[model samples]
Target: MEQKAAAKAKAPKRSQFSGMSKALVRRETISAYLFLLPSLFFFVGFVVVPMFICLIYSFFNMGLDSTSTTFAGLSNYVRMFQDPVFIRGFWNTVLIVVVSVPAVTAFSLWVSSAIYQMKPAVRSFFRCVFYLPVVTGSVAVTVVWKWMFNPYNGLLNQMFNTVGFDWLGNTKTAIWCIIMILFTTSIGQPIVLYVAALGNVDQSLVEAAQVDGATKLQVFWKIKWPQIMPTTLYILIITTINSFQCFALIQLLTSGGPSNSTSTIMYYIFYMVYRYNDFGYANAMGVVLAIIIAIFSAIQFKVTKTDN
Candidate 1:
C-alpha cells in the first residue's frame, strides 16, 4: 500500500512538470509574436496594402481625381501590349539589363579579387573609392554626369574636342551614357559582397591547390568560384532588377528624350501617372513590371540551385 501511494505521488509530480513545460512554451511563443507585431504592422500597412491597392487599381480605369473609376477588365493590360512607347521602353530596358548585368558582375569580381589580398587600409581605400558613387545621391551623381556629357564646355566634349555631338541628345549615345552612370552606381555593393565572399573562402583549399602546382586561374575556378556562386547569383539578380528600374538617371539626364530612345518602363510609368494621369494604365504597367521581375528572379534562383 505504501509503495502504491509513493508511485501515485511521483506520477502527479511528473504531470505537473509537463504541464509547466507546456505553459512556458506557450508564454515564449506569445512573447515572440509580440516582438514581431510592430514590424508586421508596418510591413502590412505600407508595403502589402499599397501593393494590393496597385493590383486592384490595375483592373479599373482610375484617374488621379476621385470617383472617375470604371471597370477596365484587362483593357489597361491590352493597351499596354499595344502601346508602341511601352514596347520601345521594354526593349530599352532589356538592352540595359543585357549590357549592365554581366559587366557589373565581372568587373566587381575582378576588383574584389584583386584587392581582397591587399593590406586592410589599401583594400578599404579602393572599396571606398568604388562605393563613393553610391553614397553620393543618385540625383547628385546624375547632375554631375549631365555636366560631363554636355555638348558645350563639358569636360568630355572638351577632352574629345567633339563639340557638335551631344552625348545625352544623340539617340545612339544617350543609352550608352545612361548605362555608364548605371554601371558606376551598380558596382559598389556587388564589389563589397564579393570581397566578403572571397574573404570567407577556405584558405587551406586554396593553399593546397597552389602547392599542387595549380595555376592561379585554376585555383580560383576550381576552388574559389564554386564557393562564391551564391554571391554571384545575388549580384546578378540585383543588378538585373536595378537595370530594369533605370529611371532616375533617365529622368534627370535625358527625360527619355531624342525620340524616346532612353525610355524605360519605370520612366514610362512615371510619365503616365503624372503627365497623362492614367492611373489604371500606370498601375497595369507596374503589375506587369513586377511580374517580369519575379519571373527573372525565379529563373535566376532556379539556375543557381541547379548549378549548386
Candidate 2:
C-alpha cells in the first residue's frame, strides 16, 4: 500500500511537469512564429500567394481577353498528359538534366582538383578564364554558339571538315554540338564552387595519407572526393534545377527546332502561355516543375547533412 501510494504521488508530479513542459513548448513555438512574422508575411505575399494563385489558376480556363474564369478541374492536366509537345519537352528536360548534371559536376571537380595543386596566381588565371563565360549573358553565348555551329562558316564545322568529316549539318551532329555548347557554357559556376571546396580540403589529411603510402589516385579518390561530396551535391542540385528552367539558351540556339528535338519544359511552358494563350496548362506545368525542383533541393540538403 505504501509503495503504491508513493508511485501514485510521483505520477502526478511527473504529469504536472509534463503539462508545464508542453505549455512551455507551445509558448516557445508561438514566440518563434512571432519572430518569423515579418519574413513570413513577405514570403506569403510573394511566393506563397503566387503559388496558391498558380495552383487555383491551373484548374481554370482563364483565357486572354476573358475576364471570367471557368472551371477546368483536371482538364488542363489531362490535356498536358496527352500533349505530344509537352511530352517531348518533359523528356528533353529530363535528358538534359541527367546528362548535363553529371558531366558538369565531374568535369568541374576534376579541373578544380588539378587547379588546387597549382600556384595561387596560376589557379586564379585559370579560374578567371573558366568563369569568364558565366558573366557573359546566356543569350549572347547562344548567339555566338549558333554562329560557331554554322554548317559552312562555323569554326566547329571548319575543324571537322579539316579532319575530313561532315559536321554540324547532320541532325545527330547538330544535337551533339548543342549539347557541347550548353555543357561548356554551364561549366564555369560549377568549376568555381568546386575550386572553393577543393581549397577547404585539409592538407594535413593529404600528407597523413601520403605518409601511409597512399598513391595520388587513391588519396584523391578516398580523401579528396569524400571531403568535397557536400559541395558536389549542392552543385548537382542547383544545376538540375537550373537545367529544368533553361529558356534563353533553347529559345536562342535552336528554338526547339531542327524538328523540336531540344524543346525543354520551360520553353514549352513559355510558348503555351505566351504564344498559345493557354495560361491554365502553363500554370500546371510551372507548379509541377516547381514541386520537382523543391523535392530535389530538399533531397540534396538531407543527403549532404554533415550529421549523416
Candidate 3:
C-alpha cells in the first residue's frame, strides 16, 4: 500500500514535467517564427514576387507603356539566338565563367591552405587584406582600376613605357583586364570560407595519416579534401554565378565597346531594356540566364557529391 501510494505521487510529477516541456517547446517555436517573419517578408516580397513577375513578363511583348504589351509567346526567346550581339555576348559570358571559376577556386584553396594554420592575429590580418576589395565599394575599385588602365597617364602604360596604349580600348586586352579585376574581387570571400573550412578539418585523422607516412598531398587528398568538399562546392557555384553576371566592370569600363568585344549577356540585357525599350527580350534573356546558372549549379552539385 505504501509503494502504490509512492508510485501515485510520482506519476503526477512526471505528467507535470512533460506538460511543462511541451509548453516550453511551443513558446520557443513561436519565438523562432516571430524572429524569422521580417526576413521571410522581404524575401517573398522582393525576390519571389519579382521572379514570378519576370517569368510572366517573358512570355509577353512588354515595353515601358502598358498598352504596348501583347502576347509574344516565345518569340523573344527565339529572337535571342538569331541576334548576333546576343550570340557574341553569350560566348563572352561563357568564357568569363570558364576562366574565372577554376582559377578562383584553385587560388583560394591554395591561399587558405597556406595561411589557415597561422597564429590567429596573422590569419585575421591576411583575411582582411584579401577581403578589402570586397568590402570596398565597386565604384571606387572601378575608378582606381580605370585610372590604372588609362591610356596616357595610367600606371601600367607609364611603367611599361608604352605611353598611350589603350588597354581598355584594345579588343584583345579589354576582356582580360576585366577578368583580372573580377579575379581579385572574387577570391576574397572564397579564401575566407576556405580558411574556415580547412581549419575545421579533422586534425586527428590528418595526424594519423601523417603518422602512417602519408605525404602532405596524400593526407590532403585522402582526408582533408572530402571534408572541405561542401565549401569547395559553394565557392564554385558563387564564383560561376558572379562570373556570369559580369556587368559592372563592363558598364563602367568598356560599356561593351571596342567592336563589342567585351560584351556579355548581362550588359546586352541592360542595353536591350534601357536603350531599345525591349522589356520582353530583356526578361527572356534573364530567364535564360537564370536557367543556365541553374544548370551549372546542378552540374557542380552532382560532381561534388560524386567526389565526396
Candidate 4:
C-alpha cells in the first residue's frame, strides 16, 4: 500500500514537469515570433503590398493625376508588344542576361577553385580584392568607368592612342562597353560565394576519389560540382536579375542613347514613368520583367534540383 501511494505521488510530479516544459516551449515560440514581427511588418508593408499594388495598377490607365485613372484592361500589355523601343529594350535585356550569367558563373568558379586551396590569408586577400567592386557604390564605380571610357583624354583612349574616339557614343560599341562594365561589377559576389562553397565541399570524398586515381577534373565533376549546385543556382539567378536590371550604368553613362542601342527594359521602364508619366505602362513592364525573372529562376531551380 505504501509503494502504490509513493508511485502515485511521483506520477503527479512527472506530469507537473511535463506541463512546465510545454509552457516553456510555448513561451519561447511566442518570444521568437515577437522578435520576427518587426521584420515581417516591413516585408509585408513594403515588398508584398507594393507588388500587389503594381499588379493592380498595371491593368489601369494611370497617370500622374490620380483623377485620370481608368480601367485599361490589357491595353498596357498590348501596347508593350507594339512598342518598338520596348522590343529593342527586351532584346538588349536578354542579351545581357545570356552573356553575363554564364560568364559570371564560369569565371567565379574558376577563380574560386584556384584560390580556395591557397593559404587562408592569401584566399582572404583575393576575396577582398574581388568583393571590393561589389561593396563600392554603383554611382562611384560608374563615375570611374565613365572617366575611363571618356572620348577625349580618357585612360583607355590614351592607352590605345585613340584619344578622340567616343566609346559610349558609338552605337556599335556602347552595348558592349556596358556589358563589360556589368561583367566586372557582377563577378565579385559570385566569387566570394563560390570560394565558400568550394571550401565547404567534402574533403573525405575528394581524398577517396584521389586514392582511386581520379583526375582533378573527374573529382570536381563527380564530387565538388554536385555539392555546390545550390550556390551555382543562386549565382545564376542573381546574376540574371542584376543583368536584367542594368540601369544605373546605362543611366549614368549612355542614358539609352546612340540610337537606343544601349537601351534595356529596366531603363525603358524608368523612361516611361518619368518622361511620359505612364504609370500603367511602366507597371505593366515591371510585371513582365518580374515574370521573366521568375521564369528564369524557376528554370535554374529545376535544373539545379535535377543535377543535385
Candidate 5:
C-alpha cells in the first residue's frame, strides 16, 4: 500500500514536466515561424504573385503597351503548334541540350578527376581557370567571343586564314559556336561539385578495392559512381535547364539569324514579346518552357532512380 501511494505521487510529477515540455516545444515552433515570416512575405510578393499573374494573363490577348485585352481562350497555345519558328526553335533547343549535357558532364568529370588528386595549389589554380569564364559576366564573355568570331579580323579567323570559315555567320557552325561558349561557362560549378563529391568518397572502400587487386577504373565504377549519383543528377538537371534557357548568347551572337536556324524556344519567346508585342503568346511560351523543364527533370530523376 505504501509503494503504490509513492508511485502515484511520482506519476503526477512526470506528467507536470511533460506538459511543460509540450508548451516549450510549441513556443519554439511559433518563434521559428515568426522568424520565417518576413522572407516568406517577400517571396510570395515577388515570385508567387508574378507567376500567378503570368498564368492568368496567358489566357488573354494582351499587348505590351495597350490597355485593351481580348479573351484568347486556347488560341495562343494552339497557334504555338502551327508556328514554324517555334518548331525550329524547339528542335534547336533540343540539339543544344543533347549536345551540351553529355559534353559538359563528361568534360567536367574528366577535369575534376584529373585535378582532384593534384597538389592543393595546382588544383586551386586549375579550378579558378576553369571557373573564370563563369564569373566574368555573361555579357562580357559573349562580347569577347564576338570579337574572336569576327570573320575578317577576329583572332580565330586570323589563325585559320586558309580555311576561311565564318564561325558565327554560317548556319552549320553558328550553333556550335554558341555551344562551345556555353560549355566554358557550364563546367565551372560542376567541377566544384564533383571535386567535393570525389573528396567525400570513403577512402576505406577505395583502399579495400585496391587491396583486392581492382583496377583504378574498376574501383571508380564500382565504389565511387554510386556515391556521386546525386551530384551527377543535380549537374544534369541544371545543365539541361541552362541549355534550354540559352538566350543571351543567342541574342547577342546570332539573334536567331540566318533564317532562324539558331533560334531556341527562349529566343523565340523574346522575339514574340519584343518584336511582335504578343504578351499572351509570350506568357504561354513561358508556361510551356516551365512544363518542358519539369518533364525533363522528372525523366532524369526516374532514369537515375532506375539505374540506382
Candidate 6:
C-alpha cells in the first residue's frame, strides 16, 4: 500500500514536469517563429508566391486581355529555340560575357593592384574615381554615352572618322562599342572586390619574397595571384550576371541598335512584357534566365572551391 501510494505521487510529479517542458518548448517555438515572421512573410509575398505564379505561367499562354490560360507544354520553349531574335540575343549576351568578363577582370585587377600599392588617401581617391560612374548618377552616365554614340556627329564617330575608321557608323563596329561601354562602366564593382581581396593578403609574405631577391613581377605572380584567385573567380561570376543586367544601358543607348544588334535577353524580356503583351513567354524567359544564373553560380562555386 505504501509503495503504491509513492508511485501515485511520483506519477503526478512526472506529469507536471513533462507538461512544463512541453509548454517551454511551445514558447521557444513561438519565439523562433516570431523572430522569423516578417522575413518569412515578405519572402512568401514577394518571392515565393511570384515564383510559383511564374512557373505556372511558363506552361500556359497567359497574356493581357486573355486571362484564359491555354496549356502549351514546352511550346514556348520550342518557340524560344525557333526564335531568331532570341537566339541573336542569347549569342549577343554570350559574346558580351566572352569579351567583357576577361577584359573587365584584367583591367580591374590592374587598377586594384595599383591602388592597393599606393598611399591610403591616393588609393581612396582613385577607387572613388573608378566607382564614380556607378555612383555619380546612372542616368547621366547613360545620357553621356548615348550622345557619344550618335551616328552623324557623335564624339566617337568623329574620332573614328579622324582616324579613317567609321566605328559608330559601321555595323561591324557598333556592337563592339556596346561591349566596350558595358565593360568600362561595370569595372567599378570588380575593382572594389579586388581591392578587398588584395587588402586581405599577407603583406609580410609578399615583402619576404622581395627580401629573398624575388622580382616584383615574381612576387605578384607567385604569392599575390594565387591568393586573389578567389576574387578573380568571384568577379567572373558577377561580371557575367551584370552583363545580362546591362540591359538598361542597351535600352537607353542603342534601343536594340540600328539592326537589333544590342538586344540582350533582358531587353527582349522587357519588350515581351511591355510591347508584345506576352506575359507567359516573358515569365518563361525569366525562368530560363534564372536557371542560367544558377548554373553559372554553381559552376563558379565548383571552379573556385577550396579543399577545406
Evaluate candidate 3 by giving its C-alpha RMSD to the native, one decimal. 8.8
Q: What lDDT would each prediction earn against the true structure?
A: 0.92, 0.80, 0.92, 0.92, 0.91, 0.82
lDDT score at residue 59, model 1, on the 0-100 scale? 95
Evaluated against the true structure, the overall lDDT of model 3 is: 0.92
Q: Write the per-residue lDDT of candidate 3 for residues 144-183, one digit (tens) a residue.
A: 9999999988999999999999999999999999999988
Scored against the true structure, residue 307 in model 4 reaches a CA lDDT of 64
Each prediction's TM-score against the native?
Answer: 0.92, 0.80, 0.89, 0.90, 0.91, 0.83
Q: What is the descending lDDT order?
A: 3, 1, 4, 5, 6, 2
lDDT tens digits, residue span 107-146, model 6? 9999999898789899889888989888866578878876
Tell me the tens digit of each residue's lDDT in model 5 across 1-308: 34776999999777754646777878888998999999999999999999997888888999966578999999989999999999999999999999999999999999998999999999999999999999997899999999899877689988877345678888898999999999999999999999989999999999999999999999989999988988999999999999899999999999998789899999999998888899999999889999999999999989987786
What tens-digit string does per-residue lDDT give for candidate 1 at 6-32? 999898777754646777878988998
Cα lDDT for residue 173, candidate 4: 94
Pairs that collide, model 3: none
Q: Taking the tens digit of each residue's C-alpha lDDT, what string does model 4 give over 1-308? A: 34776999999777754646777978888998999999999999999999999999999999999998999999999999999999999998998899889988999999999999999999999999988877896789999999999988689999999999999999999999999888889999999999999999999999999999999999999999988987998899889889888899999999998888999999999999999999999999999999999999999888777664
Maximum-TM-score candidate: 1
lDDT: the better of candidates 3 and 5? 3
Mark the 10 consecutive residues where model 5 has the least summed lDDT. 14-23
Q: What is the C-alpha RMSD of each candidate to the true structure, in Å?
A: 9.3, 8.5, 8.8, 9.0, 8.5, 10.7
Model 1 worst lDDT window (10 residues): 14-23
Residue 240, candidate 1: C-alpha displacement in angstroms: 1.5
Off by over 4 Å in 3: 1-35
lDDT of 2: 0.80
